[model samples]
Target: MDMNAYLSMFIDESNDHLQSLNENLLRLESEPEELSIVQTIFRSAHTLKGMSATMGYEDLAALTHEMENVLDLVRNSKLKMDSFIFDTLFKGLDALETMVQDIVGGGTGKADVTAIVTSLQLILKSDYSAGKAAQPPLEAAVTTVDGSTSASGGMLLDEFQSSILLQSIEAGLHVYHVHVTIRNNCLLKAVRAYMVFEVLERNGEVIKSVPSVQDIEQEKFDFTFSVFTISGLTQEELQGQLLNISEIEAIVVTALDSETLAVLSNAPAAAAAEAVEATVESSAVKPKAEIAREAAPRKGQAAPAPANVSRTIRVDIERLDMLMNLFSELLIDRVRLEQLSSEIKRSDLTETVEHMTRVSSDLQSIVLKLRMVPVDSVFNRFPRMIRDLAKSLDKKIELVITGADTELDRTVIDEIGDPLVHLLRNSVDHGIETVEERIAAGKPETGTIYLRAYHSGNHVFIEVEEDGRGIHHERVLKTAIKNGVVTEEQAKQLSPDEINMLIFAAGFSTADKISDISGRGVGLDVVKSKITSLGGNVTIDSAFGRGTKFSVQLPLTLSIISAMLIKLGSEKYAIPLSSIVETGILRKEQIINVHGNRMIEFRNGIIPLISLSKVLDSPDFNENDEDETEIVVVRKGEKWAAVMVDEFIGQSEIVLKSLGKYLTNIETISGATILGDGYVALIVDPNSLIK
Candidate 1:
């Protein structure tokens, strides 16, 4: 069968199953006695194993098979899920995921899984209920479904195979058992079967065959053929050469010893019986794709059924992005028509333009909605991460999430993950306390970490809060002073909030020791910088002994915004309406220079005054020349800045376009927008302008 067509579907569905395995494993670990969770995990692993085998990724199948064995015992109540067992299973899962990733990266999905395999085999052999440890078995085999041991190391060897091993041993060559599986779509099965023999012959000598060499040459047997041979070549070199054959799907090359040869030749039927079942089962089972489809969501599994049977057609994201770009162009033309219609004072043109505006507004909503994805897609992976981290640190911490359903633009969603990870790790490593420390502080033994998101107007706010030891302001100040981030005298005037903010300073760390989790002064700075680059801001709030909360505020969408346009000298600028507090005329006399920077008193508080021309370095711009300037007040978190402009160009919806890649580092400008008259206006990033 051709596998290329199904490759994408395989990758996508495999990722889904891997996610299911991780989620179910975490659940099973939490509820060790829950047999149903074990069943769910088993089904996923079984399906994965089958799919991998079908796809010819033998290493992936083998690891998943070992995982299935452990899960099988758990579900049957034959083995317990202790911490050791859970750790081993999780390690297996990690190895499986890595192999899948290797396949995705165009590799053969093969990995050295000996260590993990040995661990799982130990689990299978151990007497878990009574807490007995597993010992090395002189002769070992996997227990099959019918409660029988299959001949693994030549126990099922035939007379011809045994004779060959003996001859090879006498010739001073190593004996090996090799199982060769032919590729599904090969030139000829019989010819390729001989090709396997050919490769072995070139390397050393093929002594005997399982189904007899005549049956193999005539293609009388199933797709797989086994052989016992003598080889002077090292196992690695021989295996690599065997894989070089085009029609070869899998190869299991095992070096055999004299003890195994003596034991296996005594019970050929029982040993051969083990190999017979796999062939018959493989032939009898439904096609690979069909089997994969029906094998998951077994009884007692929690798979939500939709209310209605709905049909969905997959559309490429590139197409959606193309549609959005075309609509943006249409929007620009419509704005130009609106401007022309208003200036011409024609009722027919005005009415037509107004109707078009209404229609396009609806289209805009749909396009933006199409680009909006729930933040939960990113939040879903965190629980499993937290679980593992908590176990590794030996800390009792609960990750409580809320408002995961809040939607954000996909572009913002993509960039937010790493920053959130940094912040969450900080919470886990620093914000949360150990069990003993929590007890000493008279708090609950288990620390609680809150992850939350919600939309407020045009922005989404995500908060990571922990109910453990909060930021120690004095310690932070001390570190800041030592790191030269602040002078000792400078630290004296800093408020608690200001002191907390110092944690985000570059290369800031108050940790006395370093661990894999954190304590290298790297996380918070990365979190802050990434959030800021996403046209967002992150703030820190702590209550000393109580807890700490890191709040991330991001724009709901990076592209397109309703802004108040302003004129600065001959150039026009835009300020996102989401950041605007109010627009007013500030008399030049009202702007008083306090310690060099111009400051203005508004209502009850004083705010720094920023001149647009001065910031942009406009030619012939004199801050002292204007009598009364139009001032637009913008905010960043709790801080505010009054920006002076020459005139206000009224409000309009504008598409935020990227300023060519070269202009990315422009501090005060987030992006550029096309005006109705075809002039480009710089959109001011208030968050960046605010000192």
Candidate 2:
């Protein structure tokens, strides 16, 4: 099979399965008695393992197989799940995700999973039910072993080995029977056993094996295989050396003598049968579809009929982008047809144009919706992240998410993840207080971080709020002054909100020390810049002892937007309607001068008035010299400003076209759009104007 043809599909399905595993595992931790959750997680892991094997990612398949084993034991009531098991499984999931990401980035999905595999194996071998100690390191004893006993207590020996052991015992040397147990799911059993033999040979001379060393070397044995050796080292010394190797589960080094070997060599048949039975039990791995099916109903209850599965088809993003572009061109032509129909005034042309307009409007809605992805796609990964961060930071946190079904443009969704990550980390590390502090403040020990997303009008709003120690205004001002971001005098004049906003200053951090999660002086500023570059705005609201909330407002789609077109003398400009609060006519006398800056009183508050004609250096228009001016009140986040323009050209849908590379750095102009008259009009970014 040509795996390359299915590579894209494999990556997508792998990510979905991994996400399912993460979510269900987190659920299982909270509800450990829920076997159904375990079944779901087991199914996801099983499917992922099968897919990885088919794709030739053996390391991925191997790690998932080990994880599946532990899950199997838990699901089948053979073993109980605990914190250690959950953490081990989560780590395996993390490693699987990392390897899949490596494959996504055009690399072979291989990783060193020896440590994880060994941990999982140890979980299986541990005894949690009786509260007894789990399996210990290598040991030696005179008693016969439970599973198998060959010669000299437990090491199967032949005539040559018995002679060697007897001579060594007579010569006052140490002849020991060593039984090594390998992990059940070890991928390279023969190699690990070989390494054990090499260690034994370096320390001593090997005498014999139960399965005829050839079978062991060829990987023919199950979990346990016995060996007899003569070494001068003590049992402790030899046991310690073998324990250093990776996958061996247990080791028993029984000191041998002439009497013990003679008595043990006589009864090999019964012991060999026992060893064979034990091997069969340990090495058996069966398909776990039964678990998934079994969880469908209680033991005595009837099974319910299956529900209908939602139908969906995976479409490549590039194909969607192409479809959107073609629709955008069609939209431009539609607007041209409407304009020409209005000008020519033919009855048939007018009727046909109106009909085309209605049809295209419906098509536009469908196309835009096709690009709207649920925010849950971005929010689903946060719970596991918060869980890990809470563990790492030693603080208890509960993440409350709402409106995950809110949708945004696929382009916006891709860029929004990093900023949200930064904000969430900030809340986890700095915004949330420690357990002791929270207790002293009469708050719950577990801090809460709320992530919410919703749609308002034509914009989507995302908020990251925390119920912990809020922003300290005095401390923030002092740091801002000491860091040269503001003078002491300037800080004293600033409001609490403005002071709170200073945390977004470049290279600004209030941590006393740097740590991996944060406090390196590089988070909020990046958040601000990234959100701003995406044509969005972020605002902060905090009460010193209460909490802090960061609200980000973003346009629904970046490619096409309904903009309020205006004329700046001979040039036409379009302002995004999402940013416009209202439009009205204002007299020149209403403008007030505040410390040599133009300000205006509107909506019971005073805001800055910016003359677009003067700002854009218009050749034939000046709104300032006129007795009355047409002003468009626009908002950044909470800040507001009025933009003076020569004329309002009504609202229309416009396709946003990038300026390529050279003109991308322009401050006020966001992009250019083709008007119905075939003239290019630059889109104004109200965020730049307001600040």
Candidate 3:
């Protein structure tokens, strides 16, 4: 089999199963007695086991199998639930996840899990023995029924024994009679006997049956039944087939009743039942015989066969990307056509353009939606992570998530996981406090962390809020000063927000001790850079001793953006609409020089200005000939910077094309886009340009 083709599917399904297990385990910890939750966890483990086994990953299979066994013990009421048990099971689950990860990372999924496996096995064994001892009567009842024999002056035959007898007869071998008994708790004994008869008929023709047909039908038989059949089948095959039926007492096939068969050479099929009944009535049979029977049919039958479910075929992500690329090309053509139709001003051509516009717009929406996925797919794994972290740190913390169903472009989704993980680790390690500390501070023992997401006006906002000790502006400022990130004078003049922003400064840490959870002084800086690189912004809001919240705002998509096109000297530029505050034409007299730097006064504030041609090293044009320059006021965080351009062009949606890896060290230009005239305009990275 070409397993390589299924690799992506395997990764996706394995991830889904792991997420399910994690979420269910978190729920089980709170509602340990919830059998449904335990069952769900078991199902996930079972599925992962089957998948891994099929993939030839034995270590993953073995670990998941052990997890399933432990879950089974819990599910069946054999093992009592406790914190210790939960912890051990969670640890086992963690090991299984690690094995799966190893497989994902191109390894053989082999990990030394001998200790955990041994612990789970021992627990299972102990629980099984205890359960067996608790129901002694049940065991003895089964044993006695298994040992009883029929009284035809010959041994009675259990269903299993009868099956063997029939098989031997069919195989041209001598048939035998065996003793049989049924458990006292068995119900519907007559129905069970009938079912057994039906099975026996498959191998041979029944010659002599016991208990008189009327008495057997009226439930007058003891725990055992006898049958004589002639056929040519193997005893082993017959015994195996009968045992497969759910509840059977025992089977013993021996040489009894070997000589009791009267030749029915002239007898028809109708006489077989009567002959068996006569033999039983003539012999002295045991008065106390029990028969096990099936339970009554329930009200609701088994879920209507699962609604004849069908699955969707998964398409390759690469194919989707290619489709999106082709769509982008078509979009460019649409724009060109619209521009041409307007220039010509032909009524019929304009009408056709309008129709094409509607169709193309609809197509664009459908294509964009194809890349949309719910954020919950990523949020689902964190509950379990937070639970485990809280237990390890011996802290009481609550994780509250909202807007989990908010959707984002799949391209953005793929890169957001690591950044979110970093933020969450920071929350648990530094944002929340221990129970003792929280109580001493006159606050509730349990701290709350809120992770929220929502969409607004073509953008998405994700916020992480914690209600523990908030970020200390003084500490942040001091750290910045100590690390030489800012001068002492700069730190002194910083506002509270500016001081809080120092946390994202490189090499900044406020933790008293370095630990695996956080405080490595390498997290938030990377987080900030990552978000910024994705055309997003990260900001902090904090009140000392209250809590802190980090908000990240991102555009809806990255492939194409609505931008304001402008000309600087002879070159054109594209500024993302998401970052544009406002644009206006400014007379040359409105610009002033401050501290040897160009400045512009905008709405009562003197914002620093940079000429686009000067910053981008484009060919300098004669400012003497131009009457006025265009000013674009852009905001990075709290500060605004004005950009000078030669002329103002109208806004249009443009597809962003990356300048491949060959064009390294291009500082301020984020990407390039094609205009309707086939000219390439550079897209500006506002943050980099301003800094």
Question: What TM-score does each of the candidates earn?
Answer: 0.63, 0.64, 0.62
Q: Which scores better on TM-score, 1 or 2?
A: 2
Ten residues in sequence with the least summed lDDT for candidate 3: 138-147
**Top-scoring candidate (TM-score):** 2
lDDT of 1 by residue, 285-399 (tens): 3333343355447889986453224475556778878888899899899999998998999999999999999999898888888888899989988987888888888899899
In each prediction, how many residue pairs overlap at the backbone (N, C-alpha, C within less than 3 A)? 1, 2, 13
Superposition error at 435 for model 2 (Å)? 1.5
lDDT of each: 0.78, 0.80, 0.70
lDDT string, candidate 3, 1-691, tens digits: 5677777677788888887887888888889888768756766776677667656777887788877877766765566677766777778878877876887888887989998888777777664434555652312111112222233223233334344444555556746432334455678565455545545554543434555333454567676765554434455445434443444565333332333333222233234334444544454333221211222235684422322145667777788788889988987887788889989999999999889879977877777778888889888878888887888899999999999999998877878877888888888888887999889988899999999988643467789999878887777777788889999988878888888888887878988887788872459899988887766778888777778888887656656677889887778899888677898887888878988987888888899987777778777564546678777888765668888777778888788787876663576777799888888999887765564
Higher-ranked by TM-score: 1 or 3: 1
Which of candidates 2 and 3 reaches a greater lDDT?
Answer: 2
Off by over 4 Å in 2: 129-315, 563-651, 658-672, 679-691
Give the TM-score ranking, best first: 2, 1, 3
Reference-based lDDT, residue 316, model 1 = 78
What is the per-residue lDDT of model 2 for residues 358-415, given as tens digits with 9 covering 90 to 100? 9988988888888999999999999999999889989999999999999999989999
Total residue pair clashes for candidate 3: 13
